[model samples]
Target: RRGDDGTALDRLAGAITYAARLIAGATRRTGLREVYSPSSSTRGLRKLDSWVERALLEKDESLSTATAVAAEAIRQDLPPLFAEVVGRVLLRIGRLPRDMPDAGDVAYVPRAGHHMPLPPWLPPSRILGGFYVLRPIGTGGGGSVFVARRAEERHEETAETFALKVPAYNGAAAHTLSEEEFLRLFREEAGALLTLPAHKNLAGFVTFDAGAKPKPILVMELVQGPTLERLLDKRAMSMPLALSILDGLAAGLEAMHAAGIGHLDVKPSNVILRYPDDVGAPARGSTPSPTPVLVDFGLAGRKVRPGCGSPYYGAPEVWDTAAFGDRTDPRATDVYAFSCLAYEMLTGKTLFSGDALPVLIAAHLTHQDGPESLQWLRRHRQAQGLAEILSLGLRRDPRKRLTLSEVRISLAELGRKRLASLSWPLRN
Candidate 1:
């Protein structure tokens, strides 16, 4: 009875080892007579096989524990390095025993070259179908963005532009959100945008199409401007210009809020600056410029968009226990982000500086008033007389925050004051 059981274990280990080799795409010429067939030392072979099977079947998560015990038990009787090789082989097959650290054994290494299985649903395309690709622009976590021409249009003469976002092949799988769900959301975005009406200050969606293969491509008006993050990297903004940029952005937010839509992710990357004739102003443009527009609705949500600001710009309310879920006021969140941006614009530095550790330390300090933060506020006052406006605008408490309407009124006043500062030049 014991001999029969030993023979069965021998066959099982051989079969499992073969399967592991096949998965690793190793050639049949692994040069092991004992592995492919019975050997001269059948007694030794049977002994090693029995010990290896018992070790592998052990409940201990650490592969090294099993391998070490198996090696010691069968080393004298089995072939010189047979146990060592088989242990390495098993690890390559992803059966690494957990919880065994520093076991003084090399796990497993397989020869490279096996192509991983590709998902059946995702068909490869030389060029993405359904849209005429003009140029590839950038890529993000969800997909690649491209500048593409619209396939069909209402009027032949009306030149249209669209930013096409495509999901990338992560070399693992090809799957997508359901076509119906994507279309429904797409239509919802377009409908909401139409009610709000397209403007120079907002990056508007024209339409969305899910190509026959079920890949979604968003069509939006081409918005041009360096991201606010990029602008802040170069230098600080003058008080008058920062206010000008904020005014335009606030107006755009107001329109969005009135239409019952809240931009959840209102970071500097989503904010774009457009200047007349493609020539951005030297600083923030005290004079009339094109306008600043907001982009990226991928993270945009409806129903009082929650705290989605970047970690650095995120308000205190974002971490509050009472601020759970998406019910927090969008205006308040945007206002907080606006203050962070304004602070960066005037100081040429992030409100929280240095690496992630230092930044996180600044974020959690209860008594930290952020000295650099106060400098920008003071300079804005000196340059543009926005001292009073920013005083309450930058308040950490949401209850003390000003509404977008209040911000708009304050900005219009700032604009008038800036224009008044040049009262002599206008008179001449």
Candidate 2:
């Protein structure tokens, strides 16, 4: 019996080693060449190392022995980083020994005010198709975003990194829609992103793996800066910086509109601010120019239902989806939301704020005057024209709203005026 157990363990270890190789190869093909490199000091590698070490040194000897032995053999047999990854995979899949104490009986004590740790069942580390999920970056009603790298090795110099968006089935169960409907919506989002063409100001779509087991994953370029919402949380932005970001975002929206794609959800939270140096090489002592990239196209479409986006950013027609239905122009909705974002950027305050969605919607529908935050901006006589430009986009009547191209042109003129003002003082 003991000999049989040893043989079984060896076979499991071999399977785990093979799985590791497959994962490494897949990531490599996706442009993650350094995934299994021992010398690489990436956060993902560090987390894997820590998890493996903890599993190996677990107090339950019976439970840890198989995994530890397998991990040690892999460490000796494979490359250092590869061994660590394999060890983690094995630990994730390996069953607890029969002799171990029941996990249910083990009570966990929270440390002071800190919340109790999430249940173990919550995190299943199984490989989802070919993408190895590194860590979750954000979660929303639609889905969760993970920092994932391709596991297959490809003949490329730099491995491509991506943000994987997966549907949140767990939370979707309580939603009004059925599980099937929710999943279909998720798939639709992936399809929309895949069909869109590459644009500099738009988040770059890499690939969509709908065939992925369990759930489909949408892969997009991993932008390395904070969202505009987060930036606003830190501090208010300068006029020049705000206008530059607005220009980039307007251009992105224009491209999407031209492609017959309407990003219904165009708020500060969905805009990422990436510095020029982050995307490519920069000149020496070059001033950092942040480019705003529009993202989160989950609510985007040429003709989408009106009630899909955040209430605070929704256009007047969007508030009553039941009445407007499909007649709602998604482009107009985007313009309205873009105006709200622009207002927030100009003055670090949201146009509407409330706990209830209905109240927020009502405010958006009934409130005719511009945001109070913009009043200060308008007070700056030099920036009055900028205020008027934004007003045109925020017009309650969708027909009166400025198209993305018009907004872009208006912003360009405003930018020139602001630049001239700055240089005029210097010339004097």
Candidate 3:
């Protein structure tokens, strides 16, 4: 609607009001929690976040002017969209004091300079019953992981730390799982980690509290290192380092299977390279790196659930019901998933790399042949042997897939040193 006085300040304010209503919705509520139901297909928070991003990036004169006016014109009762933008700005310019939800809660977001501010929705209280939450490390589908240490007044003793996993539904907008259901999963994860024996390769259990007031929490041994995903992004690995990482991960998976547990999810990101404290950096060199520890037991356990885990690395049996279904071998699935990671490690690209989840699922179910990366492996010495081993693991039939033990034996049999790039790899 063109106004009589298009450039006037009053016309601009009126236009902004009209736009906010039209965008957010005419009759819909603008406050948090009331805006969208948990099961609502179109989540309000995500919509608000998109608008915040749009406002920040918008270069159009009229749109930018409208955004600026909204930023300051909010006298009180800020809408979720405007609230998110203001919160982001406030977080950027520090001076956020810890707002204790309870007394004796000496809460503070440690290394505020190092970490991007924890969003307003997930503002964690430092004290979680008996554990001291240090800082947020990462978040996943049902919960968030934080670097935590045992509650102790003696600061020096607090050197020993743990990864405190707390069930968080505040930002579970993408998920359809109810808050109670998510928390139940978190509890099961804690149980699974607790059941497994203390192994160097796995993220060993520390403790957990299922009956905590607001929500439950799971504490695990904090693996101090970068994820394999981050490492892969930084540089291509040498043949030895790559093999070494594979060996470590295999051992962990083997151990899990032996104890009647299945690491249904096995990918680069799940593997953590735990380097010695003395080591200067993660870069490959003469210095020894320990067996890469595997973390994230969320999808882990002996139970057979169809169509689960990361789609990119899911095996044939994992994708199909008629082929294997609930009778699928957990060990074979892990081996196949590991093979996918191994393929990516040796070659610097994912096998079935794409965005379409459905197309990728179809590829896993039908396509068993080599991807485009095979040409890159051509003319190499150990490529043939490695390819053979990988073929056995990546077979469409779960029955034909290599067992973790079989994989380990085959890898040990290889004369990997012949692969010239077996010792020192480039960082780039």
Candidate 4:
């Protein structure tokens, strides 16, 4: 350990720079001559053996130990760049002796790699980047969200709890890009969150630091509420509550689309009904005036990206992306998904369900009806005009889809009318 400040950040930057130099050197050589003269390049495969032993002797245990763990996990299967032999060191947890070492560790990415199901484990209270990690709230397609608070409580605004999303970059996604490039994409996508227009119905982004070692983190205002999916499982929402939620969701979508971004995954699970100080069962009349907060921006980005959305919610263009591909407007996918959401919200029913994804995709593409929840629509059309508006949003063609502004306007109009309670599990 060449002593400077012996600070964790300094040591980490040194380690990252060293490893990058090694990879850069190795990539410069090719053919049998390069293989025969391994040491001439980046000191060959033996570099890793010595590198691990040399990392973090005089550094912060929390960050250094975590980096060691992450490096070990990532190096389990290093990819060759354009046929250059990138060294691979496969690691497996043989067994941990009962010594119970000084280091506090959690979040094992399993043999299946980063995309695997969230392993059940209680993360010990620790500092991750600048946030004090409390506990994980949920894991999704792209990241794991944790309930955390700022490490420094000096600022009044930074004192509140925040949702911290740590990336779970898919292994398959990095097939074509170098490790550096993939990491850059993660940073770019996370930074895009800062560009989102502020709205009351959307979870506010506090900050994003992609430079956080091992993984980047995003912070957002944590709303106290159950996911809309979880809420609906208990009982169907009342007329005013459902309509109010619909209004909030549409408004959020309008903001995103107007900003030229899209909340591609606009489903029940992503919407949270923000309640009072005590999170409780949603009461009558819009859950005693709760605000619907649209959360989860993992897949939220430019309309052209986020290719598709949640199953049963994605539109025809999204479901068959290969056929539609670049022609599909990303924002249109949200409009379609919102329609599916609105349908289920009112009728306590879904238009399609299948055990397999292909079956589900087939249902989405071929689905046709005057109104998706047609019978329920027939019963409620006399009372309010939301059903037809939803039908327009669900149009198969992306160009034909309802604009977010249009949906917002419709919801605002419906908000003024006295709506009859939607008999969920509807019997027409």
Count the clashes in each prediction: 2, 17, 0, 0
Tens-place lDDT per residue, model 2, 310-338, is 76688877666555565666787788888
Candidate 2: lDDT of 15? 42
Q: Give the whole-model CA lDDT for all candidates, comma-separated.
A: 0.52, 0.62, 0.61, 0.61
The digit string of per-residue lDDT tens for model 4 on 269-372 reads 88877777645543333346677899878667663442347777877766555566665777888888887887787667775678888888777888763334
**lDDT (10s digit) by residue, model 1, range 47-90:** 44434444444542444544444445344323446646654553
- RMSD for each model, in Å, please? 21.5, 17.7, 13.1, 16.6
TM-score of predicted structure 2? 0.61
Model 1, residue 362: C-alpha shift (Å): 7.0
TM-scores of the models, in the order given? 0.53, 0.61, 0.63, 0.63
Model 4 vs. true fold: TM: 0.63
Model 1 misplacement above 4 A: 1-130, 141-144, 152-159, 166-191, 209-217, 236-239, 279-288, 304-307, 317-322, 357-372, 375-388, 394-400, 414-428
Full-model lDDT, candidate 2: 0.62
Candidate 4 or 1, higher TM-score: 4
Best by TM-score: 3
Model 3: lDDT of residue 260: 74
Residue pairs of candidate 3 with colliding backbone atoms? none
**Best candidate (score: lDDT):** 2
TM-score of candidate 1 against the unseen true structure: 0.53
